[model samples]
Target: MLHIWGRISSINVKKVVWTAQELGLNFQRTDAGGLFGIVKTPEYVRLNPNSTVPVIEDDDFVLWESNVIVRYLCAKHSAGQMYPTDLRARFDAERWMDWQQTTLNPASRPGFWQLIRTPAEQRNAAVIAESNAAVESLMATLDRHLAQRTYMAGEHFSMADIPLACEVHRWFGLPQPRQSRPNLERWYAGIRARQASKGVLDLALS
Candidate 1:
């Protein structure tokens, strides 16, 4: 069994949990961050120096970082399929996964933090507005990118979609005005409809 340490409310954790479910891996998740408060302990510190949610232990092997964990699991369990065997397709998948963490998540997180996690009285409208604008622009990017392709990597669903879908779930759940992005919406609808998306995608952002 795979042992995961993280709260489901964390987007990073959601990515891991959804990937495990999608791969049909048996996993037990332990709450360990934010309000849960176990991460600072010596044991968790040994597992992840960054003290982040979503550190996974498979038997004796320990891994951290949500995207890396997703990649590891996919490659280890479903090599030629969900992991993408073709070199071009594999790197393409890697690119989109990197985009989710490096580009999209940064742009959207401020607004998500402001609206969902922060108290209204203490919220900074300016930051939220800026984040919303940046994220809307990224949504348009995804829309155009998906105008031709069905999924992030290619025709078949792959590891690339997991992180990006979690990012989309966070952004779309934010209460704000956004331009109609038909292509992006179409892509995300497919993601949300996946059986593996049930718990992660349906949850309210925290």
Candidate 2:
């Protein structure tokens, strides 16, 4: 069985969990980061030096980085559908996986830290406002892409959808002025209907 070290509340961790379920891989999840505090322990740090949630041990092959884990699992178990087989299609699927890490996550991370991690009294109003604006700008980029395709990569549902789907949960759940992108909303609705998504990604923010 695959063993995952992370707290379920983490968006990154949630992405991996949902992907595993979608791929029908049996996995054991252990609480590690945030309130759990196990991520800092010597044993956990050996697996993930960054001390982040979502380090995984698949037998002897250890893996960290949530998006990489999603791709690895999809390639190992569900290629052609989830991971895709053609080089161009796979690259297209992977491009958005990288994009979420490079673009969307950075913009939203500050807002997540400010709103959820920092207590309201200790929060910096100016930073929070700026972070919210950054997230809006980042989302506009996604809206543009989603307008053309049902999924991030192309016509098919693939691993590309996983990372951004987790991010979308946060975007829709968060309170703020948001543009109504019908195509983006339609894409999200399709992912939300999946059984694995209902089990994992639909959980309330912690």
Candidate 3:
């Protein structure tokens, strides 16, 4: 059985959980990080020096980094299906995944931290406003891309959709102005329909 160490509320952790469920792999998830606090312990540190939620142990093989874990699982189990077999298709998926990490996550983090984690009294309105604007700008790019395709990489769902969907869910959960982006909304609706996203993506934002 695969063992996943992380709290369910973590967006990165949710990515792994959703992927494992999508692949129908039997997994045991142990709560760590945040209030759980096991991440600082030596045992957990040995697994991930970064002390982040979501470290996976597949038999004796230990893996950290959420996107890499998703890719490894998909390649190991679903290859030509979820992982994408064609060289171009595989890199397309990789491109979107990288975009999520480098572009979307940074633009959206401030708003999410201010609105969800920080108390309203202590929140910086300027930071929140700036972050929200950045996120919206990036979302516009996604909206345009999605206008032509059903999923991030192509028509069929693949590993590319998972991380980007998770990042979009974070942005959508913030209580900020959301301009109408029909294509982004349409793409999200499709993601919401997937059974594997039920306990992860469908939940209220933490």
Residues 1-206, candidate 3, lDDT per residue (tens digit)?
99999998899999999999999999999999999999999999999999997999999999999999999999999999999999999999999999898888988888899999999899999999999888889989999999999999989999999999999888888877789899999999999899999999878887
- Cα lDDT computed for each candidate against the true fold: 0.93, 0.87, 0.93
TM-scores, each model vs. reference = 0.98, 0.94, 0.98
Give the distance in Å from residue 95's predicted Cα in candidate 3 to where it truly belongs: 0.6
Task: Name the regions of candidate 1 deviating beyond 4 angstroms.
Answer: none
Model 2 TM-score, 2 decimals = 0.94
In model 2, which runs have C-alpha deviations exceeding 4 angstroms? none
Tell me the tens digit of each residue's lDDT in model 1 across 1-206: 99999999999999999999999999999999999999999989999999889999999999999999999999999998899989999999999999998999998888888998899999999999899888888888899999989999888999999999899888888887778999889999999999998999999888
What are the per-model C-alpha RMSD values against the true structure? 0.8, 1.4, 0.7
Q: Which number leads on lDDT?
A: 3
Measured with C-alpha atoms, the lDDT of residue 126 in candidate 1 is 97
Candidate 1, residue 117: CA error in Å?
Answer: 1.5
Better of 1 and 3 by lDDT: 3
Candidate that beats the other on lDDT, 1 or 2, i.e. the better one: 1
Q: Assess the local accuracy of residue 185 in candidate 2 as a C-alpha lDDT between 0 and 100.
A: 87
